[model samples]
Target: MCATLVGGMDRLKREYINAAKANGVELKVFTGKENCISEKMGQTELVIVFTNKVSHAARKEVMHYAKSRNIPVRLVHNCGVSSLRQNLATN
Candidate 1:
């Protein structure tokens, strides 16, 4: 499955990708600092957002984009690798 992750610690980006890979998911992560976040989240099967780390505008955009496309969004406040795996496993 393909997943897009927004927020989470920038230092753990590689770990996040590895964790997703271990779960058999292809994950694209955005730290919320970049421009055009919603546009970059292309064709994902799932949208995982770290609520505590992401900016309000970025979160809003992600929600809108995912809703419009009928894609599932998972909100994780903790933003840990373990939490990511858990969310990915759930669906």
Candidate 2:
């Protein structure tokens, strides 16, 4: 499953989701509000926060929830390798 932070919905059109779809993957967009985001999280396997604008509240809540569920979080800007590098740099 896939859910993006606010402003990441455009990725669905920017070719990433399309590639996933071409590879026969199911991508889901989180359209609900704050409380709804948690509910949506339950149905998803991972949360990809593409936008830096994600609120502090959402980040803390989602990170905690995802951690408890063993769900991985990814921040993909364009490619997977660069994302990994960025994550590693942050670490």
Best candidate according to TM-score: 1
Kindly list the per-residue Cα lDDT of model 2 for residues 1-91, writing each as its tens digit. Answer: 3433322443343454555455444555442234646666445655665445455566667777778888777755443423423433343
Please give the CA lDDT of all the candidate structures.
Answer: 0.93, 0.50
lDDT of 1: 0.93
Residue 74 displacement in candidate 1 (angstroms): 0.9
lDDT of 1 by residue, 8-87 (tens): 99999999999999989999999988788988988999999999999999999999999999999988899899999899
- Residue 2 alpha-carbon offset, candidate 1, angstroms: 0.4
TM-score of 1: 0.97
lDDT, candidate 2, at 75: 52
Q: What local lDDT does model 2 show for residue 14?
A: 41
* Angstrom error at residue 10, model 2: 5.7
For model 1, name the residue pairs that clash.
none
